[model samples]
Target: MRPPTVLQGAPYPYRANSLNLFRLILAGTVLVAHSFYTTGNGEGPHIRGENLGGWAVAGFFVISGFLITRSRLRTSAGEYLLHRIVRIFPAFLVCLVVTAAVFGPVAMLMQYGSLAGYATTPVTPLQFVWSNITLYMNEYSIGRTLSDLPYRSVWNGSLWTLYYEFLCYVMVWLLGALAWFRRSAVLAVLAFVAATAAHALESVINVAGLDGDFLLFLKLAPFFLGGACVHFVIERWGVNPWIGAGAFVVTGALILGVPGWGGQASAPFMAYGLLWLATVVPQPRWIAVNDVSYGFYIYAWPVQQLLALGGLGIGGGALGLIVYNVAAVLLTFVFAWLSWRLIEHPAMSRIRRRVVVPSRTGSAAA
Candidate 1:
């Protein structure tokens, strides 16, 4: 069978498939992975060295790389940046306010004697909302809010990745602005190779006990670049099920066989596999219609923390832990749905109206 063709110069068909559902599943995987820690049980399952949450996050970056690159290509820089701001900041700001001002203060009162104590806490304004909103420069907790729990101190542990996601977005914009993306295939190939090499070097450095924040970026950057490379080659490669299956098999084998090098080795395969599943797999209509993934992802950690603070698994054992996780999942979904309908969607629509600009393509591209 001939490979399917996706024109490189064409705008990415954002509504063509069920990428929304795929992202939701990935977000759900992150929730499940965090359950182990949130419930004070243990770490979740890992394939090779990366845990389920890590894999899901990598998948998110991959998809972002592909879609955002296409978005930048099809629109002006100002418009691209505006869309990103509208997509990320409004809902994120809302979540920050709810978590820091509302839930966080309450948790603080529960932990400390008075609201005065919460107000005087160092992390209350500085790290919690200010740093996170500015650039995610600080960690994701305020005061001793969740300190009493088994997990301790951390509020929304899932947020560290947002900084890296934004960093990737900036990188794509810079590269596109420099005309690197407009060059011949050789530049794309070189870029991909450089990313892969950097990832490999990061793994080596990690093994050598020199790991740090910068190394974390190095580790995840390859997956993002791999997705971009796939987009560059989409016209030539298409959505071939056989090829996707083959890639999945290879990735699984590498993860199982060379557990240490598995994640780095599987980066390209993971990108291709995710794309294939997003594009080729049959999607339910309901999943296609609603996109609660971003909301779910942003709210889940706090919801789980709230449940834990409410005495979820004090002495309840395994059964109690299970109950807590299940409840958290359900409540998280509700919160996500509400966020999408009430905050995220409406905000985007309003922002679009205010910041309207004609695309360079002379048509709106998804």
Candidate 2:
């Protein structure tokens, strides 16, 4: 079949408003969940129920699918691909390098001391280099203990999710460029299918005695699918307020364990997504302009780790840990805001200008 032509239409309302806002909110939620996990409160060592923030990574993918799909449908295939790579890759590379510089030396020092007299500690510089460059640590966690790679072991536990997000971006780009799966409706359904299938496959693999780490992708499918489903409903059908509100309520109820709570622990996220969509009717200044959600999400883990090592007792009983975590969350917001203002925004502006879209009515390019 001949390739599908790019659609020349007004930007979809849901995507222009609700989708981006929801993504920021979801990113914030993931950060909060991570803060809880890193704080070591309520969690009694053996992988407690509150690890839901990890799913935020998956939610990110779904948002990406929808947004990237929207971009692909509107812009030329080359411009679409360029936009995503420009938006994501530069910030990612900077973060990766910063993380390496901060943690690499500390790790080397610790290993040096440990093997002062004995054979050089089995430190593989190659592994550290590769892991940071490729974000491989996120694929499967290693260095589970405090003694293992003490300084750099968990340098950025969250980086793994970035890798998956990048992969999804590429997938969407190819689909758009090749004009495969051109319809938004089909893409949405396919998203749901991919998510559900991923989950089923994970469960099946686990049952068949496969390694748990290998099943990570499966566990993350639902959240991504959920986001795509949201896009499909809002953009395709043009969700009315009543229906949106009803969905908000139903998703909330489901989150509260009404009809089969497979991952009820991640209910907050589902609620967040639904409510986020419901509020897309455009109230001026509804969300804070300088929302530091990304900063909070990415930086919280490292701050928590530092707190743990500082003997300030991050894992101390409930109240103390809570307080420590709260402090970290606040600090993360500050850094995130700074990063956005200084690094991310500057880069995005420059890149966005490079792929400018010409106006339809012969107006000046946007």
What would the per-residue lDDT of candidate 2 be over residues 1-366, giving only the tens digit for each residue? Answer: 422233122323432355445556666666556554454444333223435565455456655554555566667767666777766666666655444445444433444444232222233433444555654453222232234322334655676776566665665566555544565556545655665555655656678886754466555545544554455444444435554446446655554554223442242235335534535645335344543445545666666555555544454666776676567667666666766777766776776644344533222221
Assess each prediction's global lDDT (C-alpha) against the native: 0.74, 0.51
Off by over 4 Å in 1: 1-13, 109-116, 125-127, 183-185, 203-211, 259-261, 351-364
- How does candidate 1 score on lDDT? 0.74
Report clashes for each candidate as comma-separated counts: 0, 1
RMSD of candidates 1 onward, in order: 4.1, 6.8
TM-score for candidate 2? 0.70
Candidate that scores best on TM-score? 1
Model 2 segments more than 4 A misplaced: 1-25, 42-50, 103-129, 138-153, 177-180, 205-214, 252-291, 313-315, 354-366
C-alpha RMSD of candidate 2: 6.8
lDDT of 1 by residue, 23-118 (tens): 988998998888888877778698766789988998898887777776666667887777787787777878888888877877766667577767
Candidate 1 scores a C-alpha RMSD against the true structure in Å of 4.1
